[model samples]
Target: MKFYISTLGEFDIKVDGQSILRDSNRMYRIYKLFEYFLTFRNKKLLPETIIDNLLSDSESEDPKNMLRTQIFRLRKIINALIPKGELPEKYMNLNFTNGYYCLEIGENTIVDIDVFENLIQKGDKEREYDIESAIESYQNAISLYKGLYLSDNAYEVWLVPTRNYYQRLFLKTLNKYIDLLKRNEENEKIVNLCEKSLLIEPFEESIHIELIEALLKIGQNKSAMQHYEYALNMLEKELDAKPSAKFINYINIIQNYTSRNNDLDIEAINKSLEEELPEGAMYCSLEYFKFLFNLQKRKSKRNNEYDYLLSIMINSNNNKSINDVFSVLKKSLRKGDVFTSWNDNQILVMLHNVKENGTETIKERLTDNLINYTRINRNEIRLIFQPVSMENTIL
Candidate 1:
């Protein structure tokens, strides 16, 4: 009988194509003991090491005896996994010899973690001389990693380092495979691979950047922009930090892709530039807002226009409240006004054709709008305005 074992993403064992491990039959100590033995299979493990690693949290008066009892139970489970006609010793063995416990499996046994590491090693060896071969090996290895290693045992202290090692190896393999795909200009494949990789590693900024780059290459400009926005929002909301400069650079790349047009006719250019009439205030990225702010500042100076910069600060710790405040701003301000998030807790707006006296009226309107549209208290929302002509500081 052949044994099939899987420890990545989940822990499972199958004998002769039949699953032997089930949740219904799972006992805490028995399952953990079996998992520990399988993880360190064929290695000498002292009783002291086993008890200290697995039973340290529990109070055991006789830990050595407890370890022996658990090992006996594990041996019974392994024996049951053997086929009815085959000898149990031929399939698997659990033994204590030379003052060390060891679990040994037959040569016919297949373990996914062993195969995963082997494929990665094969890819590393082939990468220098045979690019296509290396890519294939890396792709196979990456596919084997369904999720974090032994995710079912996530809370186990002994599993953390090993789990992290496998995860990092998976990322490295994925990046290498992506690099080779890039060399071949297989952008669509990169897009698919990076998208799947992101589901596994959503907080991975590099994968997001790669996904955006591939989308741009394939002329999916709108999707690229949407992903960029999503990534930015995810980083800010989840990590409570802005994306790295490498990620931010994608904005310029996306803009360049979208703006590239061969049409030289003036009418066509104007048609391309034409956009729908604004319904309410316009919202933009902080980067774009800086550009608009500077242009508006120069225009106000030359034309002596009444332009005011409004800063709205939300004091609440809730992200939902901050989002609601932005929603209120969009509906309350005029179409000519523009705004952007200044930070996690603040928003900046450029109000056109508004004077110092008019600022008070606008502030009152915003205050009322916030109260009407958002659950945020009046005291939680603060608004301040300064004329564009008087502002010389950079964003």
Candidate 2:
């Protein structure tokens, strides 16, 4: 029988054709992680590494022990859910060998992410470049985006890059789709498609800009301006930045063709108001951005002005990405904003009264916890340090 893991996107998961995993979203994610092991059963993929990446930073318990418990839990449920012969095929896929879990799976059976990626590769490679065939492939790929790719689970550290790649690809295909519409002179269709693309990747500039342009081309300047303003607000609020000169210029150029500045009210052209920004960075209101600094102690405050400022800098950085590089701060962060890191040798501490502790006390607790953690895992690897301070930061 063919193996398939059913992901309800950010929702729960199902195994094979049964409800092995339930309404519990995180456990459902854990089950999805096993798919990687099932797919690549030939190599020993360490359970500890998987745990480090899969569990939240708040989850600091020994995963080697946790793995055994989780496995027991999974086996009981899976064995009950799956049929006899099918059970062996699924369970055998996860091999406990040489002190770790190994994975191996046959080629191309992955869900629609691979399907679209393969199609994109094929379409790009063809001399004639069959847009129609490519569109069909993209349609298939689009069908598979059940919501977000692996959205509900924590899998591995390296998997974040892979996951981001697919998210980017999903947005990329929308642009290609719009071009196909443009070639066919289907201008009205572009607006709806652009709107759909924006929902998945609201931060992507191209679609945001395109949505406005498509509106303008169809004599919908009012609607165009609305979308343009909305896009502007999203970027500025999220990143503390403004739009690029190109987007402003395009909107300005379109408005210039109009009788009145009803939508984009400006005395002069946006080109004159053009901003210098790094590629992929937007412009925003610097004055409105709030940096939440720590309440410092009066005694130590005299010497640690630099530290206080660094903490503010870290708060400024909170506006950078969707969440963070790892996901620790992301879950803890309110509104899930893109915040900066405290440029300190951080530690992952499981505390009894984290809310009551002072900053330095908490920081010391973290440092001690981290040192002990490293000592326990020292046999696996050497020391690694990421010092977060104002002097060494980019954001």
For TM-score, the strongest prediction is 1
Q: Which ranges in model 2 have alpha carbons more than 4 Å from their true place?
A: 1-3, 6-8, 11-20, 25-43, 54-63, 90-92, 105-110, 125-127, 154-159, 257-395
lDDT of 1 by residue, 1-395 (tens): 57888887777787766778766645767988878888788899999998889988778788888888888888887777777878655667888899998888777678888999999999999989999999999999989887788777768888888889999999988999999999999999998888777656677898888988898889776567656765665465456687888887777776666567424555644543342123477677786567556655655664577888989988987769878887777789876678888889889998887865898899899999888888878899898888887866546
Kindly report the root-mean-square deviation of model 2 from the true structure over all alpha carbons. 17.9
lDDT against the true structure, per candidate, is 0.79, 0.47
Candidate 2: minimum summed lDDT over ten consecutive residues — where?
Answer: 287-296
**Given candidate 2, what's the lDDT at residue 258?**
48
